[model samples]
Target: MKKSMLAIGAISILFFSFIATQPKIYAQAGGSSVPFLLISPDARMSGMGETGTAIADDINAIYWNPAGLGFLDYFPKQNPFDENEELRPFRQVALSYSPWLPQFNADLFYSYGTIGQYFDYLQGTVAFNFIFMNLGEFNRTSANGDPMGKFISNEFALGLSYGTIIAPDLSIGAQLRYIQSNLTPTVAGQQDAGNGNSVSFDLGLLWKPQNLPYITDRLSAGFNLKNIGPKITYIRESDPLPTTLNLGLAFNIVKDEYNDLKVAGNFSKLLVKRDSLGSDPLPKSLVTGWDNPGADWSFGLEYWYDQVFALRAGYFTEPSTIGGRQYWNFGAGVKYSIFHVDFSFINTVEANHPLANTMRFSMLIDWR
Candidate 1:
């Protein structure tokens, strides 16, 4: 146990060292294509400042950290069956929808749906997810500024994920995804607006200790590498995917029969890098980008009453040198029988911010 802790500490030190030594560069934000993929689509997670890499334990884990799925308890030993002996549900589904940048436009929206199922025989869980984004319609015009009608832009991704317990206290998972983006149709005497398609993958790891000297058993640590894939091109110029690395920690502050409180902290850094000559190689850029000033950090707290109702609040910040986004998040949730509903609101600190006053709603169902 001491050795494991020491190893973790060493790795942490090395990672921060890279961050500290990385050179600062001033660049435009939203440089990557399909930027919508980086948005957190899960309402429960978004309510908590989008910091669920370590706290994910429900079907929503399919998006935040698939490794958490391996730890789900579909069947409790104490009451495996009720009086009717109807087998409990091993499958769960969730749907979420949100108005993206509603402060600027109401036509833009995002939607996501996911399903997960546990297989006792395989000692693992499998999940499928879909995400869609509508960027709204834009007026099309000829090179001479003549109106040529209107066209809508859209994006979508489909993914398959699998998770399994690799050790007594460690779990791992992976997800493969196909992404498509359509920005425009075509214009007369101009290059035809084409659709862009690319493939990406996500990898995650989770560690939970059963017992510790002073720490509660609810403490967990997680790491996730997301959106690792080739570049997407809609025209002459190609852009890299929004690759990110996330690390997080979660712990229970209070635990009781009727009351529960949990806290979580997460840090995220973009792995894509750029130089005077443009984008760099993937393997080298991932390390060099560690020092980029775009890192994001968030902290969140949640309280629950009798496992039926929940209240959450959190704060998240990004360096001004990057996008200068800072916001406070508030959320609430209710669970009755096998149905759950969650809602979240975001309030930006800066006045007239494009992301201010955004909202997300989600519904979940668990079935046998």
Candidate 2:
């Protein structure tokens, strides 16, 4: 209880600190693409270089796939009353020590998200997801480097979801969320400071038939309606949330109690764009569309051995004419006991670029 309280307090501090340090939004200002939250630390090592469908079992499952909670068969053999019955060694709940409820179970999880989790047969899941991103620190100045102080941007979201076994082999889930953004006040001058907030929702579906062809026990499908939020503007000058639609399929070559090999494909579309050509009206002209919407697509492959070691690689690209091509990703991971750890590195395969070799590091611990 003390550890859980400490974790919660830490999460709260980081959440608000992220909000408090946010800078003002500069009107008609545009730069690089919005940096998305990487939810699965384990999946990051797979090289999708970006977000992709990841297998779930640890506490992170609350973010990657809430449906996974239903598949957990923990506490199969344990005493009715145990000391660690309600405690797990992990940063989050310790799955090994946490008991399986007779009908339902609940847990609090945090990775990139600070969330509370609940699951049962009737209602698939009830979860809350929170995300925080620090754009680092930047000074706002004219073409000349003058002291314009510093600025930052931050976001917060509250979400709830429910999923059920709709078909004998199919499960579907949907999430509703409220999002708030503080882009900074002074950046807009006398205008209202462009502190914007909006509401969004997500819908997802998963299928795994009882029987199939060549592959007897290894097939899954998933879809998500992501970022379906209200169109919000920083001073009545609106910009839609980067809403997107995603579809994915995964097949296992060999599904055994000890090991398996799985390959997956994902197709996604960015909802906000400026026609096929990158052209827009007056205000939008200040910068090309935030997302030109050409090839915001990605694909990845993962190989697992004995559920202990894994390897992955993939690629992502927009259009060449727009803002150069995107980047390529490579990653690998390892799992042990009730703990899972992973890492991912992204590099620009396209010719010479300064930020080409930049890499991001991540980790996950599924304690209880």
Candidate 3:
């Protein structure tokens, strides 16, 4: 069966559409493989133009910056509105879903789920996450152009994360993940179609000073180095994982009993290098990749009212050599006792863009 070649082609298409924001080309982000890992899963972060490196405050921190988990409010606080003295959440679970590339209307979808727990003995938070992406159904064909039924394609990842406070005002976190892609099914009488498995890890650090003297402890900074692993192979050809470095800054402009406003900025760079010959191996590529183009950047603002509702807006942009995506994100979120809901919408600058009308929805349950 020639499923490998066709399935391989489809993988590229999905990668570009979902991550690089380019449809026909994989040149962006140095021709990454399994680029789905780069997509921001939670609607809150997606609404913030994927600028969550510094604001990783919820269960979704497992994907943004696990280090934020170390700062979770471990003590169960009293719910003010609950006259029954119900305890507020100290652990969280989140689910995020999106209809990918809705402009294409291809039945494609992506989903993510994560949960976190605090361990007093370990003085840290432990988390787990699962990611799933449906690439839709593909029509199969034989060598003679004969119909050979259809097959569904998909990809998934499983991850575990741990974050702990290493020092005052500082924390460190790590994540390990298993990735798999089922690009095509095996034929009864032929060899298996395209598929692959890989493993990767991430490292992150966050610093939030309580007495910095300048911003009244409102400023925070963080960094995440993600997707550090070996290449993944479908059959013979291998491609580098979408290794990346993310840096972010966040600060509260206003905070009070009834109102809160925060602004965040983020910068990200690809760390995979390739040329006509082949791709450079890890460690080396991390250095050479920087020589190609500038990093992508985004700015976002979030405002919360009485800790019950939020309004968010953000803009993201990148250089032309690096997918050239430019878009605005707007969203709102609501919290009711132990449940939270968030919604986000994308508006692209370019007309008729594949991602022009994409939307994301997320729900969270926090409990003690």
Candidate 4:
């Protein structure tokens, strides 16, 4: 009776925790002035130049797709830490476990995901994740260009994910998350520009079909719906939420225990208020793509060796009608036991954009 009661109590708490996470809404009028936390992170070692479903394994998976954590198979075996293990901390603050420690383990992985299509169970695994992002520090400025104050922007997320062999030749998974964003409010130029707090949730699914007797495990498909939350806005100015629907497909030309190669394509739709996306209203004369209202499609690629090191790259476009701009991405990562670390560099192909040379880092550790 005691055991059963404990199990029921745990379930009740988890259920209520999931409900407590409310969705965020955007302001209606000051549309374009959204917080920078909305920008997605680079999940690929070779910065995928576009936005797509992320396939990440390290602690960073907490940010991209928590479902990837189901792949951890390193439990209940040999010592997770031995004499030769080294402490690895990279540019992004990701923690790499030292093999010298006793019973130490870490898990870090990136998923090769896309926007659409159904994948089967013959391959792939389940996973979990935790993530934190810092938006750097800045001083609040008044209209006269005087320093009014200082503030910071940041985000935190926790996720639970599961993947299963749903069919003889199919594997699938999903993730549920609780996300929070905090951007300090400030008065900028002629108005009070800074925004405050927002809460949201995310859902993701991945599927990989079995390889045919004659065909190799070279192809798979995936999809995800992210940042689907309530509207968030400041005072009189109200904007829609920064919701996005994503779809993608990938091909693995090379796969083995030691090395692998994967290429993928994705499409995304930004579900915010129309006026918030741009200054002018659209006319019937405009014929635009629904997957990416103001942007073009994205392409990404990944390569790995011995599951110890990885490299990635990608490209993204912002259609010509809205003033086209291109992005280039690059990233690299390393894994040791259950600890993993990653770093990525993002920059616009266009030289002069203020957001051009951005950098991101990630870390993950798993111990049971």
Q: What is the lDDT of candidate 1?
A: 0.78
lDDT for model 2: 0.48
Model 1 alpha-carbon drift over 4 Å, by segment: 1-30, 77-89, 188-194
lDDT, candidate 1, 109-207, per-residue tens: 889999988887878889999999876666666557666666666789999998889998899988999999886676567675656889999999999
Top-TM-score structure, candidate number = 3
User: In order, how many clashes per candidate?
Assistant: 1, 13, 0, 64
Name the better of 2 and 4 by lDDT.
2
Question: Worst ten-residue run, lDDT, model 4?
Answer: 97-106
Tens digit of per-residue lDDT, candidate 3, span 1-368: 23433764765575576465453225534777887798789898888888899988888988989899888756454656767775443588999999988876678789999988888788889999999988877778777778778787888999999999999999899999999988777876866557888999999999988898767789999999999999988767888888989999999999999999999999998888777678889899889888757688999999999989999999999877666788999999999988999999999998987778899999999866
lDDT of 2 by residue, 182-261 (tens): 55545433667646677766666667665887666577776665666556556666655545556666677667777766
lDDT, model 4:
0.46
Which candidate leads the pack in lDDT? 3
lDDT of 4 by residue, 1-368 (tens): 11222232342232212111101211221132232323454444336654345454333333344333333223333444675554322112233211110111111111221111112342333333444544434455555766665655444555545544445534345555555444455444335433433445555555545664655555555556555444455544543444555666777778888988877777755444443354222221112213233534688787789978988888876554433546777877777876556666666776654335555555544342
TM-score ranking of the models? 3, 1, 2, 4
Between which residue pairs do clashes occur in model 1? 89-368
What lDDT score goes with residue 305 in model 2? 85
Ten-residue segment with the worst summed lDDT in candidate 2? 96-105
How many clashing pairs does model 1 include? 1
Which sequence of candidate numbers ranks them by lDDT, best first? 3, 1, 2, 4
lDDT of 3 at 291: 72
